[model samples]
Target: MKKGENTRKHIISKAAELFNQKGYAGSSMSDITELTGIKKGGIYRHFASKDEIALEAYNYAGSIVGGHIQEAIRQQETAFGKLLSYLRVYVNVVEEPPFIGGCPLLNAAVECDDGHPILRQRAQQGLEGTLGNIKAIIMQGIESGEFKADIDVDALATFTLSIMEGSVMMSKLEGDNRHVRMNIENFSAYLRAVCVQN
Candidate 1:
């Protein structure tokens, strides 16, 4: 990458960390500048405003978490395994220090609310993609006779997402991953309950 691109990425990465920790409204350009060790002019050269930086940061964070889950789901051959992989990846993320910041989409969604239109939209898109992936796995399971036909995949996906995000939020707020693990266990239970006998 060019020097300019590298600097821009550096700014976005640092901004993402800050935005994840302190939130959009709570974060400032000065914070980004200080954390990235980039001067004000350098920051302005990359991003027009803090809002733009926050939006890009939020998008980057979402992509990071979402991509991890997608890869995990795709790697498993069976629907049951995929579901388990989906839930397990979160636990793994929590175990890893880097992704331990919790769900970035959840963090941005909660922080943005109705305030940040662009960031909120990106967050919503990220969540919709997540829920859709889970729902697809459930649908595949049902089609394969591994899950009951009567199961509400959409509702189950939504519920599972809620539980997962909630658990991550709680765990991060409390500085522990125990709650996240418990929530993943509960998701596994929910999956088993919905799965049909082969």
Candidate 2:
């Protein structure tokens, strides 16, 4: 890659780690400079401000989690397996640190709040996109007669996401992964229960 492109990518990558660990408000320009071993003015050449870096970091972290789910779904043969796979993916993700802190999107939601509108919107969009993917898979199951026709795909999708997010928050705050595991299991059980055929 070109020198400038490499520098920009490096800044975004290092900034993502700091933002994920310290959050937007907690991460300062000097912190990023120290971590990256780059001067503050050097960072400015790549990013206008901390907010710009935060937005990019949020997007960068979000892409990692989103890509995992999408890959899991793509690998499954049926919608039944896909939904289960999605939940399983969440289970595995939470067991790992950083992710164990929960989803970047959820973290960004609470961190950004009213202070950063762009970051907040990115979080919202990330969540909405995740829900939509789940809803689509549920709809597919319904069409294939695997899931009950009466199942409200949208409602169930939202509920499933809510449980995961809530459990993640609890796990992070409590410094335990048990709640997250239990929550994912509950989601899996619910999926099996709602299916037309076992």
Candidate 3:
């Protein structure tokens, strides 16, 4: 890549790690300069302010997490397979996180809530996109006769999202992967319960 472009990418990447781990408000321009090893003027030349960096960093972090789910689900033909693949991403994340910190959406939601409006919106956008993907899969199953016709699409999708994100929070809090494994098992059974069963 070109020099400026490479620098911009590096700043976003390192800033993503800093903001994600340190929280947006918790991180400062000097902190970014220090972490990025870029001078204040050098950083300013690339980004207008910390707000711009936070937005870009969140998007950068979000793309990694979102890309994994989309990529995994795309590998499956059936809705159940797709859904299972989505769950597996969470399980896989316990071992291989998508980025420097854990799930950006989860971290952003927690850190950005009630403040940091831009980051909050970005996180919300990421979540809505994910929920839409999950709901679309459920809808596809309904149309394809894979899932039950009477399945509560929104409820199931919401439950799956809650389970995934909540389990991630608990697992991270306790520093244990078993929480994810156990939740994945129960959620997997829940998925089976919603299927046509024949």
Who wins the TM-score comparison? 3
Give the per-residue lDDT digits (tens) of candidate 3, residues 16-129.
999878888889888988988999999989989889988899899888877887888889999888876656777745567666677888899999899888888888898898
lDDT to native, each model: 0.78, 0.78, 0.83
Candidate 1 C-alpha lDDT tens digits along 1-198: 899999999998888888887888888788888999999998999888888888788778877776777787778888777876655666645557335366788788898888888888888888888788889888888898888888888887888777777777676667777877887777777667656554
Candidate 2: which stretches are off by over 4 Å?
A: 92-101
Residue 175 lDDT (model 1): 70
Among all candidates shown, the one with the greatest lDDT: 3
TM-score for each predicted model, relative to the true structure: 0.90, 0.90, 0.93
Clashing pairs in 1: none
Q: Write one digit per residue (lDDT tens) for candidate 2, span 1-198.
A: 898888888888788888877888888888898988889888889888888888887777777777777787789988867766655665544457434245787788888889889999988898888888889988888888888899878898888778877777776777777777887677667778766565
Model 2: lDDT of residue 76: 90
Which is superior by lDDT, 2 or 3? Answer: 3
Per-residue error for 39 in candidate 1, Å, reads 0.9
Q: In model 2, where is the ten-residue run with the lowest total lDDT?
A: 92-101
lDDT of 3 at 166: 83
Q: Residue 195 lDDT in model 3?
A: 68
Which ten contiguous residues of candidate 3 have the minimum total lDDT?
Answer: 92-101
Candidates 2 and 3 compared by TM-score, better number: 3
